[model samples]
Each structure stands twice: as C-alpha cells, then as structure tokens.
Target chain A: MATFDSENAAHLHRELHSHLPSDPALRVKTLESLAIERGLVAPQTVDAWVEAYSEHIGPKRGAQVVARAWLDADFHARLLEDAAEAIKDLGFQGSATGHLKAVANTDRQHNMVVCTLCSCYPFSILGMSPSWYKSAEYRARAVREPRQVLSEFGVALADDVAVRVWDSTAELRYLVVPQRPAGTQGWSEEALAAIVTRNSMIGTQRDLPLEAS
Target chain B: MDAIHDLGGMQGFGPIPIATGDKDFAALADWEKRMWGLARSGVAQGVTIDWFRHGLERMVPSDYLSFAYFNKWCANYLMLMLDHGSITLEDVKRGHLLAKEAEAAPKSIDDVLASNAQANISFEGACDTPPAFAAGDAVRTLRIPPPGAHTRLPRYARGVEGRILAHHGAHAVPERGAEGKKDYQALYTVAFSAADLWGPEADPRDDVTLDLWEAYLVPA
Candidate 1:
C-alpha cells in the first residue's frame, strides 16, 4: 500500500541498489525551480494541470460512462462502436484517449489490460495509472501469467471463461466493460456508478458488487 | 536488445503494492511536480511524445533503473531541450535562463491542456503498402530485436506464435516514430494462448494479445 512517491524515494535511497551520486530530489528541485524562476513556465499553469489530472479526471468519470452504458442500450452500442467519440459525450477528451477501444466482458469471455513494455494508460480519463500498474512486477506478470496475477488481485475467473489480456502496446487505450452484476437490472445510473471501482474498469477486479457484499 | 525496462517474465520482483485514494500525488516532492510540468511544457513546445520517449530510452541501463521516474523525466527533458536547442547547457547548469533567444513563450493553462489533447492524434499517417496479415490469419512475430534504441515490442513477445485479432490499419511505425520519422506500418492485435507463451503452467483458457506492427510479423 505504499505510494510510488514515498516508496520511490526509499528506492532512490537504497544505496545497495541505487548508484545515484546525489539525492534525486535535489536534482529535480533544482531543475523545476530553474524552469519556473526563469519564466520557462508559470507556477499557476503547472498547478492547474496537476489539479486537472488529480481532481477533474478520474475513475468516477469512467464510472459515469460505464453506468450510462448499462442503462441505455444505444449508449452501450455507441461505446462499442466508437469509444473515443462515446466518451466525448461526457466531456472527457484528451491525450490519453487517443482512439480508445472498449472490450466488454461476457459470460464466456473476460478481458484484462496490461502494458508490458511501459505504462501506456489513458491517464486523461482514468486519472494516473496506479503505481502498481507501473511496477515492474505487474508489467511482467500481467501478460505472462494473467490468471495468477488476477488471482493476486482477488479476481478468480471460472475455468470455462476465456481470459483475454490486452497488452496496450500502442496508442489504443482499452476500457474493459465488466459484465453487469445480477439483480441490478433497473438500478439508476447514479446507483450503479457508486459501485464501479477503478480496478473493475481496468479488469483487475470484478464489477461493482450487487449490494456491497 | 533486452533492457532493464523490458521486465516481462523476469523474476524476483514481487507482488504489486496497492495505494488507494488521491493521496498518491501528495507523495510527490515539489521537484517531481516541476519535472512533470517541464516535460509537459516541452510537449506544448512541439516536442513529440515518441521523441521524448526515445530520449529516455537513450539513458544508460543503470540510470534507467536507478533514477526515480520523474528524475528520468527531468534528466531526459534537460537532454532533449539541449539537443533540440530549446535551452543551452548553461541555462540548465546555472539554474536560470541566460539567453534572451532561449526563452520559450510561456503557454496559458488552457493552451497547455489543449496542446496535450492535440498531441493525442488518431492514426492518420498514410500507408503505401497493403497490410500483410488479416484477422484470423496465423502469424508469428520475428525473433529479431528492435533495430533502434527504442521500440514498443517487449522482449517476451518475440518468437511467439499467435492469431491476428484485427488489422488496425497502416499507422506511423513506432520505431520510425522514435527516430522522428513519419513512416507508416501495418499494426494488428495478435492473440497468443497463455499456454503457448508460458507453457502448461499457464491457464489453457487464457490469451495474451499485443498490438504489433507488420515489420515484426511473418507467416506462422
């Protein structure tokens, strides 16, 4: 449960592993201060961009899309046909969404996403890719041993269901539309959106539970 | 050919560590934020993502693994700015802009965000040749490593057999993209059985699909 920011600092300090000549923090601070002090960028502009990513964009935006798709058949159709345009309906458009392709999970097929080479996620929509998603372990095991990896994430798939691991190695970002849970046929979009976790949307965990266990 | 960044199937790295909530960024020191902002600013100044990535790839393996992610971003941004003539080494070393000619016009917040959106262009580059593989066609990735300093193809995916899932049209070749070339190559999602990729230890019902370019594939 360690944040990459905190954990990475520890990693940087691990002299046994790191060969850094000085604290990386000092180097970055020097560069960042220089960039702002010299007017290469304004402090306010950087703050705004960070605020946009941390607050404006996130799994909730994705949950809204998922919930609407579950409620309206046509919206679901649109989502499958052209995800980039469909997502734009909710006013979520940006760099990370370059040609998004949504793959729905069904009774017979399950979808999971990983970027083995690098963390090429739709950050503009899904917020920051989780630190784990960027970890060397998740990147390596997600593709080579997905079922095992999923099990570690607490997703136990049925043996008969085929699991599709999408290695997002290009500009195409994937959104896994997990199967709608049973007994939620008439739920409101707001109600459904409450249950969709970021993990479920990424296919590492199951869709929102029907009534919170 | 195989870099530390190519971590797939490598052992010893343990389970994923999970961190919840918005506090993730709170862990960022002020410098990391500046590093990120500077990189985005570079992008706004017309530096291509592929080109920036190529700059990061140019890092020596030790530095690649040792430097924190944002530190890598900082180092690469400095190198690219110097290489692209956006800034001189004196500007970086002195921690201030020394030349009137070196100053890049500061972009507004809206302009920065808009430029970020525009950078996410869809597949628009032209392809002079027809696609070499079709959906449902069996194809095997060539065992060759990427010819350049950077590539999207992971090491584990090479020499594997898989079925073409879809033809995503001719797109700018990633290898060429890294080299600042606008060349096009056929791209497809090829699906390999987990068992095929990892032997019987893998689940029989699982398939791993990767988006690979035409230059990386051949008849199975």
Candidate 2:
C-alpha cells in the first residue's frame, strides 16, 4: 500500500492510534500499516522496523529465561537474589537490572510493574513494550493505584496478599519477572513463548487464557 | 534525584547556553583536547575507555526519565543515520538534515525539543484530575495485588498511608500514555514518613513522599 516519507508518512503515523482496535493482534496490524505509511519499511529502514518489531514480538527471550529459571530452583534463587547475574546466565542483554534489584513475581504476592515516569522496560527479555505500556495513562495511573490498574487488565487480587508497587527509579529500573502459568505441564520454550504474551512479562497480563473462537 | 543537567532547575539563569547544535562536531573533534574534569589526556572517572563523562544529572519527579527516553529515541534515529552514513553529527549541527535545527540556534535542550519535529496526542474522556485530595492531607497506599501491571507501590509500603505533600501536576495515564504521544495524565504526591511507609525500623523523621494519583488512596 502507501509508504511514508516524502510527505504523507507523518500524517499516517499521527493517525494510526486514533482508531486502534482492542484486539492486540489488530493493533499490531495497525502499527505495521503506520510504519509502512511513515516510510519506516524502506529497505534502508529495515533495521529500525526490525528493531520495532523485535521490541514488540521478540521480547520474552527474557521471559523464556525466567521460565527456565522457574523450572530450576538454584537458578530461581539466583534470579531472585541477583537478576543481573541470573539474566546473564541466559545470555540476555538489557539495562534495567544493572544496578537495581530485579523482583520476581511469586505465589504469595502477585507482582506488576510500570515506569510511571517513563517507559523503562526490560526490552532484553520482554521485547518491545506493548503500545499501552508506553502510554502516559498507564505510567501515571500504574503508580497511583496499582491494584486498580491491574483490575482494568482483568487481574483481580484477593484481599490477603499484600501489594508492593516498585518504581523503576533512576538508581535502578524494575522488571516484574512474572510467574510461569500452569496448564502447560511440560511445554518447551517455543510453546511457552507463544503463550507468554508481552503483557505477561510487563505484569499487565494475568493467567486468563483467550477463548477460542 | 537530580535534574537531567547540572545547575539544577534554572536552564539559563547564569550561563548563556552555547549552540551545541551544529558547531559541536568541529568542537567535538577537539573534544579530547578540552579538559572537562579529566586530569590530563586521560578519560574521566565513571566513563568507559571510549566514552567520556559528560557529568550530567538527569532527574525528574516521576520514576523513568521521559526526556531521557525521548532523547534516546532521537539519538537512536541519529545513529541509524550515522550507520547508513546518511549524516554526520557535523551535518546534524549544520542544520542539513534536521528539519527542526534549521531555525535559529537552539539555546538549550528545551529549545532543541521545541524546534524539532513535534508529535501531539489526543485523549478521549481523559480525566486530568482525580478529586478528593489536597496538599498537606493524610493518605495511605492501598494494598491491592497487581494481577499484571508494572506498579510503583513498594511491598514494604502496602496499606501504609502517607500524608499528602505538595501535589505534583497530574501525570498522563500510562496505559494510554504508553501509546507514545505524550499521555502524561494527572498525578499527586503523597508523603509518608519513612517510618510509616516502612516501619518503626525506618527513620521517623525522614519523610518518604510518593507521586501518586487519587485512585491509590481510599481516603486514608
């Protein structure tokens, strides 16, 4: 179809979000169209486009690391104790855990994350942040009432488990490192990665599965 | 903690900002010649062998540095240009490729942002204010588990109510803000004595103020 640059690209990108669909898949299509319109798909722009795509789709090579850690205890403890080191074990690359402690989601208290100030996420593990993750709305509200924010995501927590909202401060940014879900008793990395949506890695998603049409 | 640049809040209170927009490339060619805190010809502390320390402090009230991220996005785009040999930092300074810098010399970083390509966002039914709180009021953080969100309420501070300190401006809603066109919604700061948000183990005199919105407080 139409591509960006020359003149009309900015107009297309400016309009892409205006009517974004609720369906994540549909949203991805919308972004792709915008990228094309913006001339982001030119052969010269392939790297940038690939980078954008990876940011959205290629994330969770980090989650796969987390999943493997869930399968192994010594690794799990190491991950909880020192996320940077634990992550290095998986040969993943990122910036958030270099100085700060990376907290893992547990059975006791389900965890969520956000860069209320900005969109500082673990792109190494989770890939590109979902469009919502970068928006100012989530950034501002995620910190104010984390529970309510999670509720909007359809994640309702029971009263017992305490919530600890962590900020990805300048000293050290944070990553949720969500717990692996059940049902896939002996799934491999590929299978798990398929189900391990980017939202799950960011802590905005929950265990609920999408119903089949 | 600190503002992105040194000299604190004021951008051009004392020093007249030199135009680093175009002439910087030639100046940077002699960057190694300039003694910017380095003892002699060596690299400054806190920098890698190749990277020099600019000694800038990037900070704001909110958690992540949006400006830094924005700068990062710009820098990456520039790097992409560099990789393709599309333009040099000198070209960037010369106002050759940049649509924004072609104007008068940018006085400061803010000036640069003003000059460059701008992207504006529109919010639908966006609530800029969540009423029911004021500065110097007492409040507490609700202890609700996050199903799937990256939140800021520390576990140690759960159910811990803090007093409302200076109400920072309303932040954009992040869920929508994440869409990237500047969705900084409304937000407020709730102050908690480090002792209260933490515990008796914390310093009673030390206060811990958090930038929060009305949704977190249940009229504590």
Candidate 3:
C-alpha cells in the first residue's frame, strides 16, 4: 500500500488552485468529508460498496464461469450461446454485462479484447479493469499491432495461429474463453478455477497449469 | 473529433505494461477509491454512465493522461455535478456546500449499487430506423469530423473499409445521447483486415473488429 505524497499534493494545489481553491485530490476529499458531515453520505456505506468490488467481486467470479464451462459441455454451450442468461444461471449479473459474447481461443485462432474508443469492459464479471487496459498505449497498439502488444505482455503466439482483436466500441462485452489446459480431464470445476486468472480471460496472459495454481 | 482519446492503430506509443497475478482494486490509491465511491453515487442521482463518460471524453487528452484513472473520474464527476447545478463553485471553493447549496445525494450503498448496476445494461431498445448494412456486407466508414463534441466514432476508424461481422441491433446513438437527444441507430460489428487498416506494418492475418453505428458507415 502506497501513501499519498505531499510534494505531489503541493504541485497539484499550485496548478489547479486557479480553477478551484483546493487541489483536485484534496477537493474530492473535502467533498467526501462534507458529505459525511451533512449526513448525505455514510462512510460505512461507501466502505461496503468498495469492499464488494475489491474483495468479493473479481476474476474469481469469471474464473468460476470458465471452470464450469470447462467441466460441463452444456454449460460451455450455454455460455457461448447466451452469456448473459448463462452467467445469470450461475447467479452472477450486474452492470456492463447485458450482452456478453464469449470467444474461445482455439488451436488455430486466438482472441483478444480491447476498447479502442474507451475502456468498455465486462466489469460485472471480471471486476474493475486493470490500469494498463485503460492506458493510451494499449488502446493505440492493440488494434494496430496486437502481435507486438501480446508479445510485450509475454504472450508469444506461433506465426501460424491467427490473432483476432475484438474492439469493444459498443456495449458488447467479450470474454476470451481461453483453451483449457491438457491433463485436467476429470478435474472438478472448483479445481479448474484455481488456475484461472483475470489476465488470462482478458487474453493478455494464459491460464496456469494445475501445478502452478 | 480528431481528439487524442480515439487511440487505435496510432504510432509513437510504447508497450503495454502487464501486472502480474490478479488483484481486484488493490492497486487503487485511497483518493481513487473515494472517487470511485463518489462516481458510483452519482449514478443514483440520475447521471447516466454515458453522461459521465462524455464528461471524461470532454477532457483534454494530455490532462486526461496526467491524472490517474479514478482521478479522471473524480474530475469529471465534479464537472458534471457543477454543470447540472447540483454543486456550485462556491461550494467547491469552500470545500463544503452551504446550508442550502447541497441537494439530493445517494444515502445508501444499495442506491449507488443499483444505479451502478444500470451501467452494465446495454443501450438497446425498439429502433424505428431500418439497418443500412448486414453481416458480410462490405462497407466504408464515413469521412466525417466529429461534431466537435462527444461521439463514439473513433478517428482511426474514419473512412476505413470493412465487412460487417454481425448486426448488434440498434442502439441509442451516443452522439445524440451525449447531447441529451434520444435518437437511435442501427449498429454492427465491422471487421477490418490488418493490411487494410494499418497497411504493411500490420500482420496480414490479423483482423480488428469494432462496433459502429450505421451513420458512421456507407456502402462500399
């Protein structure tokens, strides 16, 4: 956990005071304090909301979806056919998930998702987006040079395997159903989920083997 | 519309930095978390997610990058509140709203979460206009400047030729929605070949698929 630095705070105050009195960061803090003071906002309520996303709702939810898809053929078909309904079957539903299209990475073709306009993501399932996904560099290069971008993320695909980048410009959210690893045939859904990670589903990284998990 | 935010197939940007393992919201700074909470609360107060996004897009690209992710959200949240008259400059300057300056704000987590949950729902409904293109139809993006305001059309995709991959039905055109208009347009997933969009620098085997409104495309 990193602490806020006063040097940066001083710099911000100096730069933005002309537009507003306090530093932007301090201004937000002050606003929060005022809200609390006026009973307009409860700190506990905010903490609970923050905790729900930070602690409970995350890749593990998506991992469960992936693992269940791996273990049950019917579930896999359901997820690909209508992800929203199928995801709801598992009791997971929320924002930015109204329409989910699950693209599987096969032996010959790979899929990666990027929002070129803005960072539109499957937040309800995958949780909050990573900073790099929202970065200008990723938005620019992912469509222009996906092979290069994936390689930078350490995902070096063979030349023969074609790469398809899904730019989430509209509301459609994509989940890259990464190809399941071998030798996990008889593994339970819970066991398979242990190896699934957030980046793997984003197609920037691969799922670890059972041993790695 | 030739703003910095529409970054696709552009040059000069470096590599994407990868974070190891999966940690949800663990990397966010305290102020970022506060901004997230505040922005979530804004949804309950009638600010649409698209509206908040438009405010973010309104920012200068350089300044947008200067702030962290939630910092950008915080800045935009403040702007929207001011623009909507929910907060005044005096309130902001004083670091607290005066007795009568404060209006409606979300009081509970449920209100915020419920409104935040609405952000996930796609903007789809009955669209009266007929679709101009279908799957497998060749089309070219229109060479039009953004109305100098918020639009979903990225500059990089402008005037580029592609094939419609799928019909995503009709959506409330973001350009109109940003302007507080309720116009709708047919949308489709258009796929452009790498060579077609990026020329020789791109690998020939790759394809970039984007969801575009009908107004942004013309029959090829």
Candidate 4:
C-alpha cells in the first residue's frame, strides 16, 4: 500500500496548506476527536466503515460481475439489461450502485465512465475511485476528448471503433464490462476475475491480460 | 451554482495520472481514512448526500480547485457540522470538544452500520408520473441556469440536443434533494454525439451519455 503522495496530494501539501496555514491532517484528527467526544460516532464504527470499504467492498466485486457475465450469457444479458438488479444475484448491490448500469465493450464500440459534476462512481461495487478518476483533468477532458484521454490511458482504439463516454450526471452509476481476452477459453471465473484490473472495469484499460495477476 | 466543481468539457488542466490500477482504500493516510469514515458517518447521521455535495459545491472557487478531493470533503464535513450546530469554530480551533454537555449517546458499531445501510437503500423506485420522453425521442437539454445551487446538468451538456437512450425510473432529484426535499423525477440516459457537443472537429462516431433528470430536458 502506497501513501497519499499523488500529484494532487503533493500540490495540496505544498500550495494549499501554505496559504490556509492549517494542516488537513490535524484538522481531520480534530474532527474525529470531536465526533467521538460528542458521541456522534464511535472509533470502532469508524474503523469498521474503513474496513468494509477497504477489504470487503471493491473492484473485486465488479470483477466477479464481469467474469460471471463473460461465462454466463444469461447473466451477461441481465447485466446489460438491469445491472442494479442483476448484481443482487451475487449480493453486490449496495450504496453508490443502487441504480447501476453496465456497458459492455465490443469490437465496434468502447465504453468509459466519468463523473463531470463530482466524483460519482459505483463505489459499492468498484470500491473507492482511483485518484485520477476524481481529478479535474479527467472530468473535464473525458467528455470532450475521450479518444485522446483513452490514448493517454494506453487504450488506443481504432478510428472506427466508437467511444461512448458515460458521464454519471445522476444517481445512476456505470460499470464498463471490458471485452474478455481471447485464448482464455475454459478458464474458471476466479481465474478470469484475477486478471480483471480495476482500470479495465473503469474503461481506462480496454484489454485484460490473459493470465491472472 | 455553476462552479469549478462541474469540470466537463473545459480545458487547460493537464494529462490524467498514469493508470496504475485502483489504490487500496487502506493505503490512505490515517487522517484521510478518518475523513472518509467521518463523512460517511455524517451521512449516516442525517447529513444527506445531496447536502454534503451541495456544501462541496458551495466552497470558494479557489479552495474548490486547489484542495485535494478528501481535503474538500474535510472542509465540507466541518462546514456541515457547523451548520448542524454539532460543532463550533472555537472547538475546531481548540482541537477538542468544548461543549461536553451537548454530547449525545455514542453510537455502537452496529448502530452506525445499520444507519448507513438504512440511509443507502436503493434509490430506484416506481414513478407515479409517466416519462415524458421515450427511448428513441430526440430531446434538448435545458440551457437555462438551474433553479437551485445544486444540479446534475453539466455546462457542456446544457442546450445540446441528444437522443434518449433509456429511461431510468424515478430517482432523487438533486436540485430538490439538496434543499432537504425528498423529490423524485424520471431520469434518462441521453446520448449526445461528440459532433453535437464538441463541434465538427470532434470525431462524429463518438458520443457522451449522461443520466439526466427529466427536469433538465425538453422535447426537441
């Protein structure tokens, strides 16, 4: 696990904190202390919430959904038809995914998801959004120059393959079902899921590696 | 408020960070984790998600632009706590609880989980009113400024003509929900061609789809 040293975090540490003169780390401590002191929330509850998102809920859930869809035509159809309801079959439907929509990748069309208004994502299924997905650069350029953005993510789609960018402007969240990698026939769902990278499900990576990582 | 938070289609930021896969939630600094937990716990305690977002949107443009994502969240949490009279500025400055008598009974882990679960029930629901547009209908998003400070309509999508790809049954309308009203409206996935939104220079084959409330659209 890496520390919070992303460019945005570094920029905030250097620039914003200098001007504000109050450390966000200290402020968070104060807030947590206050919350605990006020009996509004317990320390165990906070730890539990963190554990649930960090360990229990994440892209692994989305990967299982994708892997299942790839193996089961009926589940795939249901996923594309009503993802919110379909995910319930695997007990993966919850917050941030109550109104889920699944967009599949094909030779003709590529799908990507972004939230221009804010960092809206299917957190319940895909876990916390990557730092880049929440960055201003992604949110702004994704809708206007998706091909360029996709290329930056190393996914260079051919000119004819249409790109569809889904801006989550409402409660409805999206899950991009990346095209299954070829030559992986007769693979177990677990094996397939192991190779389903989070970025692939987020539509940044178009192709999955053949072997589980 | 049309603010810096609505970042669709504007320019001059920079390239997105390289794809390194999703970061582990546990990788976050302890303070960041606490910030996340506090914000979610705050939502569990009745600070509606809409309200929390509205608070973030209300941030000063400079702060909204400069602060890290969780930093903005921390600021919003403090602002909401202040608004809810749960904390005082002095208490924040002092770094501890100043009003001990005001403390409510501490919530157990189970209580917090239950509350969060209750707060996060599926937003999908049956709509009493029928959808005004069908899947194949052509519609133009309303160009007018939103009636409230919070709206899901991005500046780029407004006034653009798009085809309804699908109708998502009624969901909480953010404009009304931001103000603490329980309002549901028909939402649709409207697909706008790149040529339509970004002009002819953009590839005609590509399109952007947005799940927009009916209130943000009109029949073309």
**Highest-scoring model, DockQ:** 4
By the TM-score metric, which is better: model 3 or model 4? 4
- Cα lDDT tens digits for candidate 1, A40-150: 666667766665555565677787888899998999999998888898888776766867888899988989888876678876667766767877678878887777778
> Which consecutive 10 residues in model 2 chain A have the weakest lDDT in total?
A1-10
List DockQ, one per candidate, in order: 0.31, 0.01, 0.34, 0.36
lDDT of the candidates, in the order given: 0.71, 0.42, 0.73, 0.79
User: After superposing the true interface residues, what Cα RMSD does each candidate give?
Assistant: 7.8, 20.5, 7.7, 7.6
Give one digit per residue, the lDDT tens place, for model 2 in B1-220. 1222211111222211112211211132211111110111111112211111111111121312332222322332332233333434444333333332222121333322222112111222355456577777777777872321223343544588777754434444432221222334345655555456445654333343445655566677
**Prediction 1 TM-score vs. true:** 0.87
lDDT string for model 2 (A1-213, tens) is: 111111221222222223323343333233223223333332223323232222332455655765676677888788767665677675554433343245676666655665543455654455444545555456555544556567777787665644555544222345566667667668766665566555665666657362211
- Cα lDDT tens digits for candidate 3, B107-200: 5555545655555566887788788788999999988844535677777777889999989788877776655566667889899998888778
Model 1 ranges with Cα > 4 A deviation: A1-21, A37-39, A210-213, B19-30, B43-46, B88-90, B99-119
List the pairs of residues colliding in candidate 4: B1-B149
Error of 4 at A141 (Å): 0.8
| TM-score computed on alpha carbons, candidate 4 | 0.90
Question: For residues A1-213, could you state the per-residue lDDT of candidate 3 as single tens digits?
Answer: 111222322233333335653355786686676555455566666775676677666788899999999888999999988897799876667867898888888888888999987788888789888889988888888988888888887787877888899999878899989889988888888888888877888888754667744
Off by over 4 Å in 2: A1-57, A208-213, B1-220
Estimate candidate 3's alpha-carbon lDDT, on a 0 to 1 scale.
0.73
TM-score of 2: 0.44
TM-score of the second chain, cand. 3:
0.86
In CAPRI terms, model 2 is classed as: incorrect
Best by TM-score: 4
